[model samples]
Target: MYRVLRGRVNSVGFLPDERLIPYLELAGFVSAALIQTFDLRYNLISALVERWRPETHTFHFPCGECTITLEDVALQLGLPIDGNVVTGVSLISRPATLCYELLGHSPSEGKFTGLRFSWLKANFEHLSSTANEREVMQAARSYIMHLIGGVLMPDANDSMVHLMYLPLLSNLHNTRSYSWGSAVLAMLYRELCRTTDPSTMDIGGCLILLQLWALYRMPFLASISHQSYIFPLIHR
Candidate 1:
């Protein structure tokens, strides 16, 4: 599916075929927001980069300030882990935001990468009217991964995650033009946040993303919205 995208030039949101233009005219709002508050936004982004995995992608926060781990917070939210599903907590390792786990046999395979976009679209486009909370939590995690991974440099021998996904994702952001696809991307952004809890997704990681949303939000939602366009060819 990714093969069809015009990329870096003709489109902004990785939309397939007909959905070739960016949908958001509100970009002036986004740009204005960034210009007036560059320092604050930069600091928030730096704080987020400082927390990226630092060890593993299990959503562990090594920062000493937190009084609780995500597990404890989940318990407080009135949920417990049962298989991949949680009664109340959104697992940061599942593709739980866009309504489907990135659909891989094991956890590491779901790691977000530029190459995985087509697969991500294929898997998420068929989401049911109602969501599986567990899956949403997991998908939310992938979004976080991509966000942090944007600035994270992989170790010399480590291969599970790549650091190049977000830079490649920037091709869309750099190609801003008014299109229906951009509007759809904005909608997906709303849904991604609605499904993923901002206060608790990553021990305030989501909150950081909110503070730094201007930078990270596009890649997270536009990628999903891009994949969502796959249906015209397959289901048609």
Candidate 2:
């Protein structure tokens, strides 16, 4: 018997404040935010996972073998494929201080592990009109953090995002220099491999990209009618 994997399709409905759009663009994530709504076909995702071959990192189909590439990530999700690798210190010795510096606030000492999506929303969802430049930038960082934890690189622990990524956003202009598309692809590949195991129940990483890639490549799998082609492709 084959087990159909469940996708972790959590809601990432928060939109960035207009004030933060300029900064988000500089960080190379503004396009991704355009993909606000879509329906997840759980059965389709489960079928695809069933065909995944971990060793090859490709789906084995009767027609031919195929896989999601960096190009697919860039076009489908609008993340930067070229530039520096998306990596840094995974362990933060002083997370509180880092948060204070980049986010303008810090969790209480000894209580910091990861930032909860709820906390991000509660604090940064709305910004005052009179907010200064520093406040606007801080809110933008928090929004990006929410996107990373809730959409791009989510893991089994769905509620909180590890503080390691916060440091990367310290320089919004330089953040775009990282190959975010590559990182998203790598995480999805790892999740696909893990789901090949019979015991695995939930799938992580960007299911939106996986489903959209399949729909574009294998039109037979899609139920929606084609629309005008959009740049990011996810918006269509």
| Highest-scoring model, lDDT | 2
Per-residue accuracy of model 1 over 1-236 as CA lDDT, tens digit each: 21221101100112212111121111111221112221223232323333333223222243322222334322222112122210122233433222232322232435443223333344433434464644443333333222222211112112222323222222233222223222222322332333233332222122222333433433443333234443332222
lDDT of each: 0.27, 0.82
Number of the top-ranking candidate, with TM-score as the measure: 2
What residue pairs clash in candidate 2, if any at all?
none
**What lDDT tens digits, residue by residue, belong to model 2 across residues 12-131?**
576778898899898999887767745776666767787889999998877678999999998988899999988867678888888889999876566476898888888888898999
Stretches of candidate 1 exceeding 4 Å from the true structure: 1-115, 150-236
Clashes of each: 14, 0
Q: Which stretch of 10 consecutive residues in model 1 shows the poorest summed lDDT?
A: 4-13
Worst 10 residues of 2 by lDDT: 227-236
lDDT of 2 at 30: 89
